[model samples]
Target: MRYISTRGKAPALGFEDVLLTGLATDGGLYVPESLPHFSLEEIRSWRGLSYSELAFKVMYPFVEDAVPADDFRSMLDDTYQVFAHDAVAPLVQLDTNEWVMELFRGPTLAFKDFALQLLGRLLDYVLEKRNQHVVIMGATSGDTGSAAIEGCRKCKHVDIFILHPHERVSEVQRRQMTTVTGDNIHNIAIRGNFDDCQRMVKASFGDQSFLGGKTQLAAVNSINWARIMAQIVYYFHASLALGGPDRSMAFSVPTGNFGDIFAGYLARQMGLPISQLVIATNRNDILHRFLSGNRYEQHQLEHTISPSMDIMVSSNFERLLFDLLGRNGDEVRSLLEEAQSGPVSIEDYRWKHMRKLFDSAAIDDDTTCAMIREIFEHNEYLLDPHTAIGVKAARLCRRDKAVPMITLGTAHPAKFPDAVARSGVVSQPSLPKHLSDLFEREERFTVLDHDLKTVQQFMAEHWKHA
Candidate 1:
């Protein structure tokens, strides 16, 4: 399978090259030139397979030519074996028609582990074969930083640097990344918001002369094709578990970077019979504004209790635009450029087309907490703040009550005790046994100003290869 950049200027690359190259040289995210489709019979045939087995069947087509079948299957076996649950992504019934898919069973209790664990293995397989070393530069609002560090910490070849907003993320989220000590892992706290850290990572990837041309950068963010590919598997997993192809499944994803819901869209393209995808957001609701009308503009970033969804810019939205605008790179570029002056809308026809299958809602902190307390009182099930937003959105925007609606439980509740307390719960959520000692562990990190040169210089000084 070949991957093409959203801007349509960079050379199309195979899966291996796309895995190694984060942002395309043209400052665009890479998407597949053509998607692999599965017939109903084909999707149904694998309904009984395990999560790892289903992942191999779903993802093999993308990397078939780049990685050998045996080696790839072995890597899949290793990637999923680390998850804490027997069923990696399991479903729990919250209501007769509503369910929650738990996605925090991995080593780092968040949804990102499904992708990053596999990404680390894939990087090791490819980099070791080429006998080369690389660096990972990623920005996370909360979960991605910890998951990326956990995923890449063991790899001998890549030195991974993750930047998160200082004093912005929750205490549990910060410790998850800062407490993991490794020669290859470095965490930086930028004195700014998530957008600033993301901008610095993009700038460094766009021009890597800061590394003295000695190394290429890998991406662990949703911008990487591997992360997206790994995410698509879970959508298929959820559907197959819920009896797919016979009945339609709908998803409500608490979105920040747009990667998770975009995976559901790809699942529909791959014939999983997804009925609806709800773009659930917190107060920082750029996606809701865009889908509600068509304006894609930035606003002031608010530090909400659901800090993971506190992003002004949704980067993965570009990939969806590439497909929605008929893959017209020039048109995509023009719309983005036009947004620099003020708000910009897509062609009316395009916006209408996207609205056909997608629904959106922006939930505030009070509503998020209310939903959390209400669910706990009704069903005795506590939801993390982000998942509470998703559950609220599902109830508000559900198109069909006949179809099963699944809200993605993105992270463990222990990650955000403040939200739990505000929900009026008497008992706080406790960390897992493995992380029972998280509070006592010594932390390590560097605080840096939100400047490109300072961030890059710090990376250059600390990078093992440099």
Candidate 2:
């Protein structure tokens, strides 16, 4: 299948090329030229397939030209074999008509592992065949850095550098990124917020000289189409488990970079029997405001309990807006640039169009903590802060048609012990064996200012030096 850049200038590419090149040359995200659909019979025929088989079937249409069916299948199976859960993605009922889709059952204990694991395998397969080496750079608020580090560590031909805001991430989250001793894995603690780290990564991608070198530069952030594509599978898994394409469903996603829920949007375009998609946000509620018809404005970066969602500007939302305007890349680019002038005012007609397919809400720290405590008391279920935001938002904004609303549980609660403890929900949680002794290890990182030139210089010095 061929992919088109949301911004029209970049040349259309096959799936594997889009997978490897995170952002389009025109500064747009890549999307499938046309979404592949499944007939009811075809959907039902997947009943007895293993997770790997189902993944292969769902992803084949997109990557058919770039990867053979057998080789891709082998890579998928090998990747998922290491997941902590037999069912890599599981659905657990939270109420009579509400369920939480748990997506953290992987080595890193975060939803990102679902995609990064597969990406690591896919990259190795292609690089080995061509005898090429790549330098991967990523920005993370919390989970993505750790998951990327774990996924690509020790690979002979891949070097990964993850930059995160220093001291802003939780203690466990910080250790997860810093503890990796692999020769190919490196972590940088930038002296700023997640948005700054993300900007720097994008700046690196736009560096023409860097892009032309033998040492390839790519991204693992959701800006990468492969990450978004991998995440789209879970929506189908949840929908089918809860009677999708047969009964309508809704989703509550704890959104940060907007890649995860954008995948759900793709699922709807693929003809899944889904209703409105709900976007849940923490205090950094730029997305919430956008959906509410208020001007989309970025506020001062505030560190919240749901630190991963602590983003003001969401990159993947650009993909959605580009699609929403009927793939008018020029208009999308103008809107993106105009927002820098001040708050972005969406036209009423345009907002009405967006509101038809999407719902949104924001929850503050106190309410998030209360949701965790209340859910644990009522059902003995432990939820991390990000998932708590989704649960609370789902309950508040669900429409009558949104039956069996599914909120994505993005991370394991043990990742944030302080928040869980503050909520008064006592449950014994064990650390992964590798991280069991992390508290005793000496933490190390080089802190740098948020200047783009400083970051560029650092990358130049460290390129392939890891």
Candidate 3:
């Protein structure tokens, strides 16, 4: 279960090391050297297992060598106990063969809670054993900041800092991160876009001397292999619930950072019998452009109603390119380096191979609002802006009618009230009881300029050790 950097320069690491050391020194994401494939019988035997039990079975192989079996099982149990839904990740049918996987039942009301909840526990366990403390810095467009802060707030061994673009995130999204009062949890609203905040996090990962070199840096973002590993379980869970490995399933994922759909790609690689993987994007559609047109180019990041998907640069796309290029790290490095100046095109053969398994559609904000209204009128299902893009893409880009298509419901609609309002729906969605007082709570966060050095200094001054 060793992890290798996509750029071929960093040393191979075990699960724990990869969990802590995100964004390899060579500026590549880490991926498992080899994936564990499940036999058809193995996949069938998982039917009727509890969500926690199923997660343990799917993820144990990756961490079995690194974590004691009992401890890992206990952590999985504790991590999922907080989800609001009994099924953890439940499936609700929208049409004959169309379904939505509800992933927002977690504490933060977003799909990120599925991974961040587990990551926080894992970090605490590992750090406690080694008697070490690390700084956890992450960038979120909206949901990840709240989910990451909620997950890691109680961890004594870490100081968690999250940065989101000021005035870019929704009111619910911003308050969810800022309202939580914990000495270890710090939120920063940067005067830039999500990509700018993300760039700062990556830059800090590359050089941690700003932390005085005594404390190591950790990541709660999808760059951490643990986040991706935890996400792979839900794909298996959803498929098995709806007849999987025996029958093919298709997934439509609304993704910005590219980590969530990359998890689906990994599931198919692990013998899950997936027929198609659809990339659903908002106005910022770099991934859509790449898969549909072979044009991997960056454009100005657009602020859409779906703020979480308002990202021009997709970081996890590199991991997929690393595989599509036959695991040739040097070629991946060369392609990405070339991408800095302008668009980079893949060879026709590689592009065709990718098209065989992947399809994409870019939905605009108007289409997203219309789909929300349409779904409500037809099925009485309320979809958030992000998930609406996924449903629309699944309908437009689906290659087959018989296969069961599942769109990943990425967030609760209440998180983006403005988008929900634009749909002309009479009843506005309300926050769940746990977060009902989100607006009333006093928020504590620092508004910082987009300068990297100033941001770094702020972190240094307020860090737990300092």
Candidate 4:
């Protein structure tokens, strides 16, 4: 399938080029020119397939032109085999008509592994085919960095550099990134918030002359179309597991960059019968304000217990804007320019159209903790702060209680011990057997200022050309 830039100016590209060239030349995100849809019979036909089988069925069309069918199938099988759960993404009923899809049962213990692991394999395949080498530069709020490193560290033709806010991410989150030992992998702690880290990465991507004109740059962030493609599978996986195509489901997604939930939107576009999609957020609630009040406003960034959702600008929102404006890239550019100075709102009709498919809520830390405690006390189930926000939002914003509500459980509780403790839970979660020695592992990382030039220089000095 061909991919087009959301910003309109960039040339349409096939999946291979889009995978290698992350941010489009026109400063836009890449999307499939036309989505491949399925019939109910086709959806029904995929019921009993394994997670790998289901993934292949959902994602093969996007990559079929670029990757051989056998190679794609092998990558899907290998990528999910690493997940701790046999179901890959398992659904647990939390209450009557409410359920949680456990998506953190992978190497990084976050939903990002669902995409990044498969991304690494795809990178390896493409780079090797063309005998090319690339550097992966990504910014993470908390989970994406470690997951990117764990995902891409094994790629023979790639150098990986990930930046996260210094002392802002949890100790577990930091260690998970820094503890990995590889000559090609580097972790950077920027002396700023998640937004600063992200800004530096975007600046670097915009101009990579800092890489000395020799090495190509790629992204492991959700900006990559492949990551979004990988994530869409599990939504279908959950629906099929719970009697979908015949029955409708709603999803409450704990999102920061908006990539995870955008995958759910794509799932709905691809013939899954989704009743609603809830935009669940912590204190950083720009998305909530936009959905509920038609105001997309900028405010000072705040650190929260759910550090991953602490992002100020939701980058993937642009893709949705492009869609809402009838794929008019010029209008998206204009709206973004308006956003640069202050708050921005879409046309009234577009705003109304959004409300039909989405509902939203902004849960504060106190409420997040309360939900965590409430679920643990009543159901004996522990939810990390992010997922707690999702459950809370799902309950608050759900329109039809009859339709099954599935909140995307974004991370393993072990990753956020501080939040767990604050929830008054005496039972601390233990790391999985594979990560039992995580705390004992020595970490390697560099602390850098929030300057793009300095970061690019450091990346240049560190990595030898592959």
Candidate 5:
């Protein structure tokens, strides 16, 4: 399967190259040249497969040409073996037709582990075969940093660097990234918001000359096609669990970067029978604003209980817009160029087309806390701040009450204890046994100013290219 840039200027690439190249040279995200469609019978046949087996079935078409079939299957096995749960992504029923897909059973305790764990193995395999060394630079609002660090710390051919906004991330989130001790893993606390860190990562991808033209820069962020590809599997997993393909389902995803929900959008493209896709957001709700009002504008980034969704700009929204605009790269390029200065609105027909598939809501901190408390009191279930937003949005924005709704449980509640406690829960959630001593671990990280040049220079000086 060939991958093409959303902007349509970059040369088409196969899976391996797309995995390595996070952002296109023309400032676009990579998407499959054409999605592989599964028929209803094909989708129904995957009902009882194991998580790894389901993953192989869903993702084989994308990587078949790049990775040997046996090797890819083994890699999938190895990647999921580290997850703490047997089901990998188990489903918990909340109401008659509502469910929560638990996705935080992985090593790092976040939904990102579903993709990053596989990404680390894939990068190691590809780089080892090619005899190449690379540096992975990613920006995480909270969870991605720790997940990426844990995923790639053992990789022999890669050096990983993750940046998060200083003092913005939760204690557990920051400690999760900083506590991991590895010479190859570097954590930087930038003196700005998540967008500043993300922009730096994107800029570094656009120009890698700072690496002295020796080591290639890789990405662990959702911009990488592999991350999105791996994420698409879980959508299928959750849907099949709820009697999918035979019946339609709905998903409400708490999104900041837009990659996770975009994966759901892809699942529908691959014939998952999704009735509706809900865009759930916190105060930093540029995506919610766009889907609700068609006003795609930037606002000041707000620090909320859900730090992961504290993003002013949604990077992966461009990928969806590219499709909504009928894959017209030139038009996407022009619109994005205008958007850099301020907000840009789409044509009425295009907006209507998007509205048909998506509904969105922006919940505030009060509502998020209320939802968490209410769910806990009524159902005796705990939800993290991000997932609380999702559950709230799913209840508020769901078009049909009869259709089954699944809210993507993006992270474990222990990761954000402050939010959990603030919701009036008497007992604070504790980290799992493996991470019980997270606070006791000696933390090591560098505090950097929010300057791209300085960040690039640090990468150049520290990266050990062979």
Candidate 6:
């Protein structure tokens, strides 16, 4: 599939080039020239396949140019080998019709691993094939850092550097990233919010000199379309298991960067009979404002119990807006600038169109805690802060009688032990094996100012001879 920039100026690129070159040179996100479709018959035909087999089917259209069939199948097989469950993403029914999709069964204990693990294998295959090196620069609110670090650490021909806001992430989140001692992995604790870390990464990418220098840079974030593609497979898997287009389903996603819900949107585009993509957010709810038509504004970050959703700007929103504007690049550009500069609103028709496909809601810290407590008390379901937000959102939206609502459980409860402990439910078997020893390790990280120049200098100095 040919990928075109959301902005008009850059030349269109193939899947491999778009995967390697993250953000477009023209300052746009890459989107497929045409969205692929799947018929109900075709979707039903995928029943009873293994996870890897289904993954290759769902992702083949988006990645066929970059990954050949044999190699892609091999990579998918290796990627899921370490998963705790045969079904990497499992569905659990919390109530009569409400379900929670548990997506934290991987090495890092978060949904980010759903994509990043395969990303690591894909990067390894591509680099080995071309005999090239790449330095992956990523900015994470919490889970993405550790998941990316875990995915890329100690791999040949790649150096991974992840920057996260210091004091903004939880202790567990910080330790998860910093405790790794791989020579090829570097972690930076930036003295600001996630927006600062994201800004620095973007600024570094925009640096022509840096791009022309020794290290070749790529992103493992959802900005790389491959990440979103990898995520889309699970939605198909979950929907098929639940009876798919023949039976409609709804999803409540605890969103921060908007990647997960965007995958749901992709599934809808692919002809799944999805009823609603409910977007669940914490205190920082720019997306809620947009969906409600109150105002779409970017503000200074606010720390929340769900630290991973503590984002002011939602990057993946651009891809959705691009589609909403009828692929009119000029309108998409104008809308983004307006939304960033101040509060802006798309026309009512546009919002109404979006509302038909999505429902948005927010839960504060107090409600998040209450939901966690209530779920455990009533249903014996233990949820972290992120999943608590999703559960609450799904409950709120269900008043409209949305059926088969599935809240995407973004991380394992043990990843946020404090929240789970506060919820008054202990694990039945206790934390998983990889996370069982987190309390025993010493956390280490280099603190840095929120300056792009400082980050560049650190990269240069630490990796000078690398």
TM-scores, one per candidate? 0.99, 0.96, 0.99, 0.99, 0.99, 0.96
Structural RMSD, model 4? 0.9
Clashes of each: 0, 0, 0, 0, 0, 0
Q: Residue 312 CA error for candidate 3 (Å)? A: 1.1
How much lDDT does each candidate structure score?
Answer: 0.93, 0.85, 0.93, 0.93, 0.93, 0.85
List candidate 3 stretches off by more than 4 Å.
none
Count of backbone collisions in candidate 6: 0
Residue pairs whose backbone atoms clash in candidate 5: none
**Candidate 2: Cα lDDT at 214:** 59
Task: Please provide, for model 2 over 343-413, each residue's C-alpha lDDT reduced to its tens digit, 9 standing for 90 to 100.
Answer: 88766788888898889999999999999999998899899999999999999989963478999999999
**Cα RMSD, each candidate:** 0.8, 1.7, 0.8, 0.9, 0.9, 1.7
Candidate 4 C-alpha lDDT tens digits along 4-49 = 9898999999999999999998888999999999999999999999
Q: Candidate 6 — which residues are off by over 4 angstroms?
A: 399-402, 424-430, 464-466
TM for candidate 3 is: 0.99
- Per-residue lDDT of 1-466 in model 5, one digit per residue for the tens? 8888889899999998988888999999999989999999999998899999999999999999999999999999999999999999999999999999999999989999999999999999999999988999999999999999988999999999999999999999999999898789889999999999999999999888898778888999999989999999998998888888788999999999999999999999998899899999999988888888888889888999999999987888889989998999999999988988998899999999999989999999999999999999999899999999999999999999888999999999999998999999745898899999988899999999999999988888887663
Q: In model 3, what lDDT does residue 55 have? A: 92
After superposition, which runs of candidate 1 have C-alpha atoms over 4 Å from their true positions? none
Poorly placed runs, candidate 4 (over 4 Å)? none
Error of 2 at 403 (Å): 1.4
Kindly provide the TM-score of model 1 when superposed on the true structure, using C-alpha atoms.
0.99
Kindly list the per-residue Cα lDDT of model 1 for residues 1-466, writing each as its tens digit.
8899998889999998999998999889999888899999999999889998999999999999889999999999998999999899999999987999999999989999999999999999999999999999999999999999988899989999999999999999999999998888999999999999999999999999999989988999999999999999988888888888889999999999999999999989988899899999999999999999888989999999999999988999989999999998887778777776789888899999999889999999999999999999999888999999999999999998999999999999999999999989746799999999999999999999999999999999999977
Write the residue-wise lDDT of candidate 3 on 24-134 in tens digits: 999999999999998889989999999999999889999987899999999999999999989999999999999999999999999999999999999999999989999
